[model samples]
Target: MFGSLPLGILQLWHRKFRLLTATLGIAFAVILVFMQMELKEALYASAVRYHEALGYDLIMLSPKTPHIVAARGFPRNRLYQAQGIKGVSSVSPIYLGQAIWRHPSEPLNRRSIFVLGFDPDDRGFEKLLSPTVLQRLRLPYQVSYDRLARPEFGPIGQMIDEGMTVRNQVNDSEFTVAGLHAIGSGFAIEGSIFTSDLNFQRMFPERSASVIEFGLIHLDPGAAVEGVRREILDALPKDIRVLTRKEFAQLEIDHWSKATPTGVVFGFGVVMGLFVGAIIVYQILYSDVQDHLQEYATLLAMGYPHRYLKVIVLQEALVLAILGFLPGLVLSVELFRLTAESAHLPLEMSLNNALTVFALTLGMCVFSGLLTLRRLRSVDPAEVF
Candidate 1:
């Protein structure tokens, strides 16, 4: 196997231009697959950013709430009832809504931004906001702008960072930008704001404080989370749905991946990339096999077993897989960084993703080589003679 490996590589190296072209083809496919997978993952990750940010043992939402951005208001009393549960430490009411944010500089231009309203004293957003930012949020009509929001939001984040007093109009109600936070924009929402529950109600006067969008339940130390969650479910009315943190995050992921067209489109892209890659690899391998047919037949005439030639082709495939995957991986990582910075989406290249793409590339090349095996097997010594 070791002896045949070098022979396979040398044969490919002898035709440097073909080797370069084949490697580039495989690399292009790898980049396509990587981008599609990363975008799909970013869709799910960004969709659940709010869910994962909150500090909660369990969460409660109205059954009618389709997603976090479109959360429906439920009675605040449901959270009060859950607070009475044995293992429950506390419950905080959260409000979610959308309001037209008039651009700070451009008065006529308005854009919809997601607003998250909760008590500054509550632990619900302890993980998401700093104590300083939370304190500022307590001030009436003071809001925190998302630093990762799109540039169209009119540099509120930049002004805040520069310690300038930034105020913006939301639904025609003036609000101060007290601070900045880093919750990124998702596909559905361009930007987000964090404000106290009082300010939230003030912006949307029709939305009563008694009706809340989410209830975050924190469990006591050493308390059984599942047990308390079950008790809360039993105590709450059918209108409210209870879910653990993991379940809540999964809910958002499932909605985007299964219910929406984003996942399907990216998935189809991955398959197409693989198909194109396979065809390129097959052509390379088939052409190489045809070019070397007489040599293969001469080996057979010299009593070289069929297994020997099979090993050479397989080794060649393995070589191509590795050579192609390396450049693809590097380019993909750089592209992910550029996309993340420019788009402000959570596009991370995880280890699992890298390994998965590598595996797929290897499989694609080997399968192509196997398809060329039929031609390899038919190389008769008599015909060559």
Candidate 2:
């Protein structure tokens, strides 16, 4: 076994140029797979940014609402009704809408932004917005801009940080940037604005306070979330849907992963990367095997078993897998960082993703090695003589 392993290493080392080419090919595949998986994970993670930010035990929304960004208003009375439920501490109504954000410096350039409206005193936003910012949002026509918003939204966050009074048109109404928050942007939402419900209505006069987009329910201490969720669902009408905070977040994730084509596209990219890697490795392994058929035949003629020869090819694959995965991992981490900084996305290298790509690289190389075994098996010692 040891002898065959050395032979396999020697075979690859003998052709340093080919070995380098094969390692680079595998590295390219690793990078492709890692980038696609990271983006897919970021897509799901970013989709639930709002849900994760909200401090709530239970959430209520209209059943007609497909996702938080596309929320349909439910009667505000539902919040009052949920407040009367046992084990309920409080309920806060929130409003969501899309408005054209006129660039502060470029008036002609506009982009759609998500707007979230809630009461200033609502405890549900305590985790997301500081009390001071919430207080500032209480004033009409004042809104907090998301600091992680895409750069296309302009330098509103920078101006706010410099203590400048930044004002811009959100729809037909001009709103002042009172503060900045850190809820990042996603595929569907380029930027976000937070304002009090009063200001939200001011920006969209057609919407009524009686109709709100979401009802955040905070359960009393020691209240079971699942039990409270069940109670809320039973108490609410068919038009309303009740979910735990985790379930609410999952709902948004599902909408993006299942309801849209983005997830499918990313998944397809991963498959294509694997396919490309396998093909490249196969070509390299096949060529290496063909080049050394005479040496392999000599070994076979010496009574060496086919299994020993197989080990040599597999050993080369293992070496290639290791060499390729290291650089790919390093490059992927840097790319993830650059993407997170530029796009304001939640892209990062996780332990699971790293392990997954490594496994795929190993499997891809090993499979290629197995394919080359056919060529080795057909080599005739007699024909060589």
Candidate 3:
């Protein structure tokens, strides 16, 4: 075992450039896998959890159909009904819509935005924010714009900060930006305005059929959410969907995780990257094994156990894993930053995610080398001669 150390080192030193290329190829694949998975996770999280940052304990939405609040919506009366449920502390009715904004004075470019309708005094409206934000958000005729919408508004924070009004070309006459919000880092409900539920209806005259887009629920202290959820679901009309806040979040999680094209495409990228990395590592090590067969045969002829040669192969795998993992980890971090900045998605790379990728990379190398050991089993001393 010890004798093979110098031999392995010498072989690596002599063939450093070729070996480096293969190692980098595997590392690059590892980086791609990390980027794909983390981007997918970031997109889903940004889509679903942006509101969770508001810190609401329960969320209610239209039961007949499902949609990400940021993407699609439905009209409903359940917003008020949720307020009336037992063990319910309060409720806030939200009207969601889309519109365009431009600086009252600018290049005069019309920009599109997402619009949220809410109440200033509702108790549930305050659950997701501090009194400071609530006060800021309640400024009369004001709407709060998210990060993504800031540009269309003309300048990110200040444009919305100074205040601007939005016209419901379709519904209400005119509305304004109440304030700007930072619900979570990276990406938000951008290019949008907030308005009173009344004003929302004014703009959406056709909305007599749907009172509020959704309702936010706050339970009385110590209330059982699951029991209340069941009670609400059973009591409500079939068209209304009722779920605990946790259930609602989980439902969104499951929906995007399993149903979206983005998730599946990224998942395929991860699997393919892993397979590609494994192949690269296997082929590189296979080449190295072929070159060293004579040395290995000499050792076997000298009474060295076959198991000892196996240890050398395992050593090479471990060396590659360590060398590759360090750079792969760095690559993953850089990728996360670039994606967050460029994609405008919240791609947070936790230590666990990097660690998981590192572990997987190590496993792939070891398994690849181990399986390719079949080459050693067939090497004959006579062939080497």
Candidate 4:
């Protein structure tokens, strides 16, 4: 068995040019799969950053709300009703909207950024922010900027860190950049601003305190989340929908993965990569089988079984998968880093993703070998002679 393994390897190495071409083809396929998965992950992760950063036990949304990016909110009066629930210990509101932000240096330049407004005094709100930064938010007209946001938001974050007084306009209303946060960006909204409810109201006078996009309900210690969810559902109006934190996060993920065109494109890219890989591998294995037809026929004439020939081709497949996957993996990591830095997306290469790609590569090569075996079975010793 061990002796036959080297025979497969020798057969592949016999034609150096063909082997090189095959390896490159396989590597390209692996890279395609990696990028597709990476983009898919980034899309989901970026879209759900707000959901993940917040530490809420239950979330309240309007029946009209479609997603976090462009959601129409429920009435703020619902928070008062939610506080009456048995397990509900606290209720807070978050106002979400978009505004054109003027560049700090380039005053004439502007771009739209997602706006998040929450009550600074509301201890029930969960966020990935420093307490000190939250304290600074108590100051009127001051907001925290996402440091990792795209450059189109201008240099407000950088300027603040440099001890410069940086202020930008949100729909012509001015706000100070008091601190920087790192919640990152999403596909729908590339830049985000965090501010207190008071400052938020000041910037958007059209948005009344009566209407809010999100209501966060915090349960008492050891309180049953499902019980609280049920209690809230029974108490809240039918116009409002209640969801657990996990369910809320999934809502955003589903929005991007199924409801958006970007997700479909990435999914299609992965399938095309697999198809291309299969074809390239099939061609390589077919050519190798053709080159060794005489040898395989001699083995058949000597009473060697068809299964042994199949095993040889499979061994070659295994070799190709391993050799191609390593270089592909190395290149993919570098690409992920470059993308994360340049695009400022939360792109990462996790261990599970690596293993998944490896399994796919093996499967692709092995399946290609199976297709080439039909040619192997047709070889006859007399015909070869």
Q: Candidate 1 lDDT, tens digit per residue, 146-233?
A: 9889989898877877878988899968999888888898898789999999999899999888999999999999999889988988
Instruction: Give the deviation of candidate 2 from the true structure as CA RMSD.
Output: 1.1
- What are the models' TM-scores? 0.95, 0.98, 0.85, 0.96
Whole-model lDDT, model 3: 0.67
Residue-pair clashes per candidate, as listed?
0, 0, 14, 0
Measured on C-alpha atoms, candidate 4 has an lDDT of 0.87
- Please give me the total number of clashing residue pairs in predicted model 3: 14
What residue runs in model 3 are displaced by over 4 Å at the alpha carbon?
1-6, 70-77, 102-111, 127-141, 148-153, 160-175, 184-191, 202-205
Scanning candidate 3 in windows of ten residues, the lowest lDDT window is: 164-173
Top candidate by TM-score: 2
Worst 10 residues of 2 by lDDT: 1-10
* Candidate 4 lDDT tens digits, 1-385: 6679999999999999999998899999999999999999998888888887887888889877778987887789887799888888888899998988887768788888998999877864335667888898999899889898899778767787789988778886788887888887767888889899998898898888889999988899999999888888887679899898788889988878777788889989988998899899999999999989989998999999998899999999999999889889999999999999989888888999999999999999999999999998888799998
Tens-place lDDT per residue, model 2, 78-142, is: 88998998999999999999999999999999999999998898778887787888989988799
Q: Output the better candidate (2/3) by lDDT.
A: 2
